[model samples]
Target: MLTLTATPVLDVEPAIHGEGPTWDAARRELVWVDIDAGQVRRATVSPAGVVAEVGIHPGGGTVGFVVPSSDGGWLLGADGGFTHLSADGAATVLLALEGEGPAAGTRMNDGAVDPAGRVLGGTMALDETPGAGSLYRVDLDGSVHVVLRDLTISNGIEWTADGRTVYLADSGAAEIRAHDYDIATGEFGGSRVFLDLSSDDGPPDGLTMDDEDHVWVALWGAGQVRRYSPAGELVAVVRVGAANTSSCAFAGPGLDHLVISTSTQGLDEAARAAQPDAGRLFVVRPGVTGRPAGVYRGPVDALHRAE
Candidate 1:
C-alpha cells in the first residue's frame, strides 16, 4: 500500500461545503468552490511560499464548480445556469435550466471536461432526493444535453487519458461507476461498478486520475484520500485530520502536488474544535503527475439531432 503524509496549506474562515478542485497550470494556481458559502477561492503557489485567498466570488449564488477554459477564463456552474466568470468577476450565462419544469430543484453539481474538451456534468435535486438528478454534456456551441438520469448527490467525475473510459462517483450511493466512452462520437456505454466505499471509510466525494490512470478519491467523513489502481485495487491511503474532506486535485507547476479541500459543515462546536483543520486546504507531494485539466467546449448544437 502507498503511504501518504499531508501538510496543512491554508486555513479559511469557514467553508460550509468545499468542493470542485481545479488547477490552472498556466497561472500556477488552484481554484475551488465553497458551495454553501457561495464563493470561489483561489490559492497561488510559487517556488518560495504559498499565497492564500488570491481570489473570491462574493456574490455567492451557490457556486458549485469552476474550471479553466481554453479562452483563458473559467466555466462556472451556478444555481439556475452555467456561465463564464472572468478573472475580474464578470459573469455571463451560457445556459439556463430554471424554466418551469420538472428540473426545478435540479442544479449543476460535479462536472469534468472530457479529453476532447467537452464538459460533462451532473445535476442534483435541492432536497437531495434519489431519482431527481440527471447527467448532462455541454458542448462548445452552448447547448446542454441530458445524457443520464436517476441520481442523487452527483459528484466526482473524470475520464481516462485515452478517453475510452469515464468514471463517475455517486456519493449518495457510496459507489463509483465507470462507463465505456466513445471519444469521437461523444457516447458512453457499458456502465458497471468501478469501486464501492465502505461505510466505515465514509463515502467517496471527488476524485482525480494520476499518471498511471489510477483514481485517487477523497473520502468524506473518513478523513482520508485513497488511491486505487485502474483495476480497482486499493493502492494507497493519505490520512487527513479533517473528517469532511470534500475534493482533491493535482496542482503545483509540475502537477506533482496533490491539493485537497475539506469542509466544516455539519460539525458541532466540539467537533470543530477537535478538528481545527476542518475546512482547510492541504497539499502534499504524491510523486505522480496529473493530466492537465480539460477545457470546456461549451454546448454542442448537434445534441438535438442526436435525439
Candidate 2:
C-alpha cells in the first residue's frame, strides 16, 4: 500500500527496521534509529528539500532510540537499557532497565523526553509476549521509577505542549491512550483511550504532537499516518508507501515538516518488491508546528552510573 502523491520521499536510508525519528533542534539535525540493523543515523536536513547523513551511531548491540543531549552527545536506548553515546562512539551506560539488565527477554523500545528533561523509556518483550512490557522514567533528581507496568508492545510516548497531558501508544491494544500529567513532579494520572484503530487498519505505532494540540500517529501495517485533534477526532491522513511506517517526528523549520521512518523487518520478498520505499525516509509539511524535542536537563552526574 505504497502511495506518495503529494508528500515527497526525503531520504533513501533504506533501514531494515527504522523505529525512532527525532529532530535535534539544538544540533539542527535529524536523528533516527535502525533497530533491527543495530545502527543510528544523524542527518542534516534543510527546508530546501535536502537531507544528508552527517554521522553514524557506534554500531554493536540493538539500538532502539536516540535523542540529542543538551550537554552534548546522544541519549541512547539500546540493549541493557539507556546509555550516552559520545561523538567518538564511546558509550556510557546510564540506567540498566529492570528486565533488560537481567537478560529476561525484554528490550528497550521507544521513549520520549519529558518536559522536565527526563526520559520516559518503554520496554517490549523480544518475543512479543503479552503483558511483558512496561514504561519507565528517569527524573531530574536522579530517581528512576516504573510508572506503568504490564504493557505489551509499548511504543510511542509523548506529552502535550503544556505538559499537562501524556500520550502513550500500546500497539498490542490497537489504541493511543492519554494521561493527566504533572509537569513539575513527573506524575501520571489514570489514562483513557484517546483513539482506537480498527482491527483491520493496523496497530498504532509511534506518534508526535503539534503545537495546535494534534497528535500524529503512524500505523504499522496500514501504510498511513493519521492526525488526531485534542478531542480525539481524526483530522487528516497521509498515505505512506510502506506498510511498516514505524515512527515519525516533525523536523526542519518550525517543526512542521514531518520526517518518517519505515521498517522492512517482516516483509517477505514479494511484499518487499511491492513496496520499494519500505525503508526510506519520507517528509511532508502538514501545516502544523510541533514543540521542540526535549533534552536532558537532569544532573549530568546522575547519568554516569546505572541506577
Name the regions of candidate 2 deviating beyond 4 angstroms. 1-11, 198-200, 299-307
Q: What is the per-residue lDDT of model 1 for residues 1-307, given as tens digits with 9 covering 90 to 100?
A: 8888777765445477888889877667788888877777877755433536677864236777888776677777777556677767776666666431125866777788888878877778877788777777776565577777887878999998888999999887889999999888668899999997756479898999998999999998988988999999999988888999888898777788888889898899999999988888887778787876787765421222123
lDDT of 2 at 126: 88
> How far off is model 2, as Cα RMSD?
2.6
lDDT of 2 at 63: 80
State the C-alpha lDDT per candidate.
Answer: 0.78, 0.80
Report the C-alpha lDDT of model 2 over 1-307, residue by residue, as the tens digit: 1223224355445888887889988888888998877787888778854668887776447787887777777777787577777766677777676556337887788998988888888888888888888887877776778888888888998998788999999988888899999988888998899888856489999999988888989999888888888998787888888899899898885676888888898899999999888888888777777876889766544443334
Query: Which stretches of candidate 1 lie above 4 Å from their native place?
Result: 11-14, 47-51, 98-103, 198-200, 299-307
lDDT of 1 at 238: 89
